[model samples]
Target: MPSKFGFIYHEDFLKYNFGKGHPLNSIRIQMHKELLELNSFFNNPNIKLISTKPCSDEDLLTVHTRDYIEFIRKLSETGVGSVDDKDTPAFKNMFEIAKTAVGGTITAVDEVMNGSILHAWNPGGGFHHAKQDSGGGFCIFNDIAIAIKRLIKKYNLQRILYLDIDAHHGNGVQEIFYDDSRVFKISLHESGETLYPHSGFEDETGIGDGEGYNINIPLPIGTFDEAYIHIIYQILPLIAEFYNPQFIVLAAGADAHFLDPLSHLQLTSTTYIRIAELVHGLSHKYCGGKCVLLGAGGYSLNATPRIWSLIVSKIAEVELKDEIPVEWRSKYNEYFNENNAPIRVVDDNPPKIDPERYKKISKYVDEITNRVKENIFMLYGFFKLIK
Candidate 1:
C-alpha cells in the first residue's frame, strides 16, 4: 500500500540552534530521530521520511511582515544581536533554518491535502511563539500560523482547527487568527499568569465574526494526567464534532512533561500517547484523517525525546518496547557524561498532589471547562453541555 503517513525531516533542521544553554536546543530533534530509528520506525512501509526546502519570501510574507523577515535575514548574515526582546537570539544562518522549518510544515500540509498521505508530521516546526513582526520564547517564525494561512489560501477551505497542547499558550497563532472565522484555534496550556508570553485565558475568545472561534483552557500549575486527560476528553470531541473541521493541525509540545524544568504541568509518556491517540481518532472521525502534527516546546533532554517518540510510534501504528534501546542509552550516558540516563521510555511515577488541593484544582478546572463550553458551544448550537 502507498504510505499513509509522511515524516518531514532533514539534517539541516538541527542547525536551528539558539546557542549553548538555550532551552530550545535543536539536539532534541536528533535524539527523537535516533530513538525512532532504534525502534525500527523507518522499516514500516506505511511511513515515509521527507526532506524539505526553505520557504520562499513570498510564502513567509503571507503571515510575517517584510520588515521582520528582512531583520532576521540581516541578523542571520551578520550574526549579531538578539532577535526578540531577549529570549530568542539570532544564530548564524538562522533565517534559512527557520524558513526551512516553515517549509517542512507546509510540505506536510501539501502531502495531506493532495491525498498522498492521510497524515503528516514535521518535528522541526511549531514555533508558535513568533508573531507577524517579532520573535519570542525561542521561536523565530510562526510556522503554524503561516502553514494555516497557506492551506486556506491555496485550498480555499473553511473551518480549519488548530489545537495546541504545548505548556505555554500559543499566543502567536491565536493573535494571527484572532479575527478570522475560518480558523478555530483551541489551546490547552499552563495558565499564562504563571508562564511565558502570559496571555491565554478563558475570556480571550475571538472578536467580530471570529467571536467564539478562539478557545483557551488555561490550567493551573502542577496539573496531573487525570485532570488533564479528563478536560481534553470532555471538550475536544464536542468542539471537533460541532466545528466539523476540514483539517486538524496539532502543536504537540512535550514541555508539559513532569521532568521538564521550564514548566510545572505534570504529564508523562502515557498521557502524551493518549493525547496523540485522541487527536488521531478525531482526525479520522471528522476530517478524513487530514491531520498535521508539529513539534513545539519540550526542554527536558530525557523526556522530550521519549515523548515525541511515543507520538511518532502512535502515528505509525507501531508497538514500542517500554525499555529504552540499550545502545541509545549507552550513547546518551557517554555524551552527557551522566550515568543516570533514563533506561525506559516511560517516566517514573509522578508524586501525588495533596488530596484537598487536588480536589480544589480539579474543581477550578471543571469550572473553566464548563465556562468554555457554555460560552462557545452555545454559539455553535451545542445545548446539551457537559455538566
Candidate 2:
C-alpha cells in the first residue's frame, strides 16, 4: 500500500548553491540528504519517495508578480545581477533553482491535498522570506505562499495554520497573508529587533477579518532548548484552541541549534526531536496527522543534519537510539576540515545545557506561557460575551 509519509527531494536541488562563505550554500542540503539515507525509516513500507518538476509560470504567478517573475527569468537566462542582498549572489540557473524549489513545495501540497500522502518533507523548499515581487534573506520565492495559494484554490481549506521557527522572521509570508482571513501565520524567531529581514512583531497580527489570527513569539539571544520547548508548549495549544486549523505547515529550521554559526538560539538535537513530536501530536489531534514540513534556515552543516535526521525519524515513525553514524562523519570530514561540516551526526555525543542558561530560559518559559494563558482567557470571555 502507498503511504501518506512521502519525501520530495532531488539531486538537482544542489544546483541552487549560493557559493562559498554563504550560509545558504548547497552543502547544507546535501549533508541533510546524506544523513537521511543513513536511516532505514525512509525504506519502511509506509514511507513513499517522490520528486516534483518546476512550477509553471502560472503556478509561480499564484503568489509572485509577473514583473518580478520576469526579472528572475531574465536574470536567470543571463546569469547576471544579484537577486539577494549582495550577500546572495546569483549566478546562472538561479531562477530555475528557485522555481524548482517552489514547484517542490506545491507538489507536496498537491499530494497532501489529494491524499497521496499524510505527511511530506520538501528539503529544497520553504524559502519563506521571498515576497510577491522581490527576494530577501537569500529566499528567491515565497514557496510557502505559492503552496497556500494552490491549497486554497483547489481544496478550499479555509483555516490554514503556518508555523515558522526559523532564526529569522518569515517577513514575506506574514506580509502576503496579513490581509487574508483564511490563513494564519505564526512565527517563533529571534527578535526582529536584532535579526535581519526584521518584521514579525507581537502587535502585527492579521488585520481586517484576519485580526488576531496571526501570532509571533520573538525571543531574546541565548534562548536555549528548554525555553523553546516552553514557547512551543504554550503557543501550540493556545493557537490550536483559538484558530482550529485543519491544515498546518511548519518551517523546521535547524539554525536555532546551539552550534549554528548564524544565530543565537541554543536549541539542541534532542529538543528538535521533541518539537517534531509536538508537531506530530498537534497534527494528529487537530488535522488527522495532516501537515507538511518545510526545510528552512540552518547554516551549521555539522549540526543541521542531525537535527533533520531526528525530525525525519519522528515523521517516519522510526526509533533511533542516541547514537551517531560513523560513515556520516567521514563524509562530513571530506567536505569540512574544521569549520562548518561535521562527520558525526551530533557532536558532544549528547547536547549539554549550561545550568545558568537553562535557568534563564526557564524564566522566559514561564513568562510566555503565562502571558498566552491570559490572552486565551480574555479571548474566551470576549467570544462568549458576544455569543
Candidate 3:
C-alpha cells in the first residue's frame, strides 16, 4: 500500500521570511512541523516526510513570464527594493528561497500523482497571489498555478479542482486559468470589499471557456463555523458529483480563524476539521484520494499552526490530543513570545456569534449560495443539485 500522507518541507523554507515586522513569518511553518513532531504525528508508518529543492526555470516559466523571472533574479542578487507593492521585500537569494517554496509544492504533487502518497501538504507552498508578470500580495511566485500547469503538461490531467479557502481570493491562479476549462477554480473567502486583493466576488465567476468554471463565494464579515461549514457542504459535494475532478488542490488559509490578525471570517478549528474531512472524502470519492494541501494565509502565529495541525490530523487519520503538549508550548513561548500561543490543539472557546449578527450572516450566506448555484450549477447541468 502507498504512504497515506507526504509532508514536503525544506530548511530553506525558513529563509522565505520577508522581515522581522512582516506578518508572513516562516517561523509559523517551523512551529507547525515541531508541533506535529511533539504530538508524534510523524511516527505513523503511513506518514512520510519529504524534502524538496528549488524548481527549475522551466517549471516556473510554465506560469511566469521570462521577464518577471529575470526581474526576480536581479532583485534577489541586489537585495534591495520590494518584490511588489512593498508587501514582499527583495532579499539576497530571495529567488532561490521562493523557488524552493514552489519546489516543495511540486514535490507534493509529484508524490501524490505518482501514487506514492494518497495526500500531501506543502506548508511552504500556496503563493497564490503571484502572477505571470509580477509578484505581490506577499507572493513572489505563483506556485499554485505552476503546480496546476505541471499537472496539465506532465500528467495530462483534466478536470482539476482548485479549492481555495484562503481569506483572500486566489487572484493569480484564477486569472491564469480564467479562460481554460481544464481547471475548475472555486474560492470561498472573506468579501474582497473587506479584505486585500479585493476580488473573488460572486459575479467574478469566469470568462470565455472558463465561464462558470471559476466560482467565488465571498462571505460577509463575522462568518462563524456553522454558516461557513454550511456553505462548504452545500457547494463542494454538488461540485464533486458534477465535475468529478481528477485531482484536487486546496489552498488552506487559516487566516479565516477568529484570532487571525489579517482576515475577518471568524472561523475556528471546528470549521477547519470539517473542511479537511469534506475534502478528504471528496478526493476519495472522485479522484482516488489524490489531493494536495498548500498553506496559504494565516497571520496569527498561535492559531495558524493549530488550525493546520487539525487539518493534517484529519487527512492523516491520526487522532490529535486535545491539549497541546506542555513541552511544545515551552518551546513556542521561548522562541516566538506570542502571547496568544494556543493551549489546546483545537479552539476551546471559539468566538461566539451574537444572535442578531448570526441572523444577518446566515441570510447573506444563503443569498451567496443561491447565487452561486444559479450561476455555476447551470453550466454543469446541475439543476437538481441547485436546491
Clashes of each: 0, 3, 0
Give candidate 3's whole-model lDDT: 0.90
Better of 1 and 2 by lDDT: 1
List where candidate 2 sits over 4 angstroms from the true fold: 1-3, 337-361
Q: List model 1 lDDT by residue over 1-387, tens digit each.
A: 233889999887899888888888788899888898888887888888888999999998998999999999999997778997587878899999899999999999999998988889999999998899989898898989989998899998898999999999999999999999899999999999999888999888999878889999998888988888888888889988888999999999999999888998988887898888998898888998899999999998888988998887787677778888888887777435357788888887666788987998899888887887786658776535543
Whole-model lDDT for model 1 versus the true structure?
0.88
For all predictions, the C-alpha RMSD in Å is 2.6, 2.4, 2.4
Off by over 4 Å in 3: 1-3, 334-340, 382-387
lDDT of 2 at 14: 85
Compose the digit string of candidate 2's lDDT tens values, residues 14-54: 88877766777677777777667676656677778788888
Write model 3 residue lDDT over 1-387, tens digit each, in one string.
433999999999988888778889888899999889988888889999999999999999999999999999999998898888568888899999999999999999999988889899999999999988989889999999999999999999988999999999999999999999899999988888998889888887788888888998888889999999998999898888888899999999899999888888899899999999999999998999999999989988888889999998898898788888888887778544545556888888888789999999999888888877766557866546685
Between prediction 1 and prediction 2, the one with superior TM-score is 1
Positional deviation of residue 376's Cα in model 2 after best superposition, in angstroms: 4.0
For all predicted structures, in order, the TM-scores are 0.96, 0.93, 0.96
lDDT of 3 at 378: 79
lDDT against the true structure, per candidate, is: 0.88, 0.79, 0.90
